[model samples]
Target: MKKIWAPWRMEYILHVDDSVKCIFCEKKQYVLKETQHAMVMLNLFPYNPGHLMVAPKRHVANLEDLTDEELKEIMALTQKSVKVLKEIANPDGFNIGINIGRVAGAGFEGHIHIHVVPRWNGDTNFMPIIGETKVIPEGIEKTFKKLKPYFE
Candidate 1:
């Protein structure tokens, strides 16, 4: 019997960084027109590569707490991100979401987000069950290169 190891997860497991601050907010200034939170970038650690998180300029926790304008921006940004991600990643499909809390897997649960992820057939597999990991065939930097041009 043999086992298949996912290369992408190695960087995730071996990779470490200064995560004390909100990376989304920090990376925001690099992007144009999308505002601070609307700034979409490649996920450093992605589910299947080309996974992105879209947020609001002002950070807020719960969805109900979001102002109508904030919600509008978030949605609009999400839609745009989906299109950009599709153009860049060219996956078979996507999985967009917002995890409200730690239990829901927000990571930064206090900051609300809309995830725009590119999905392909058979992406969902036993990696979680078998290896306690998620397999991503590509690297984050590559995804970033594919997506960065769209930030303008």
Candidate 2:
């Protein structure tokens, strides 16, 4: 028998066991930057080397649900993570966003958070055009090193 490999769809299948919730919540409970779910941890797969996601502790699906303090913390942490990403990946650009609902492309539709993704020149190519696939060029742990300091 033979098996098929799908690098992108793997996201639907592979993930940290306890990481389905807000990552920031996990960090608040444990060490600051220790494990895979640390504040600066990388995407289970990443679009670029320093791409990072910073979320809050409590799970609030709606962006409007965030308190003033949570908003402040989110901004501050995002600033920190961006700084680290610049140092580590030195990307040519960035795309930061929050996907509020399923239509907005939030994989975890019940959890709300922001995505800070570093972009390089021509990261996408014929694969996306011809094959309808995305190629994430960096490893998760490597992204962690680049963006970890912002959390600490």
Q: Could you give candidate 1's per-residue lDDT for residues 12-83 as a string of tens digits?
A: 434434474565556553232366344455565677777777777676788898888778777877788888
State in Å the error of residue 19, model 2. 11
Residue 19 of model 2 has an lDDT of 52
Q: List runs of model 1 lying over 4 Å from the truth.
A: 1-21, 26-33
The reply for model 2, stretches above 4 Å from the true place, is 1-40, 149-151
Write model 2 residue lDDT over 7-120, tens digit each, in one string.
564455344345546445543432224322224345554555665666765677888887777777777767776777677668788889987876556666666777888877
Q: What is the lDDT of residue 9 in candidate 2?
A: 44
TM-score of 2: 0.71
The CA lDDT of each predicted structure is 0.68, 0.62
Candidate 1 colliding pairs: none
Q: What lDDT would candidate 2 get against the real structure?
A: 0.62
Q: What lDDT score is found at residue 68 in candidate 2?
A: 76
Superposed Cα RMSD, model 1: 5.5
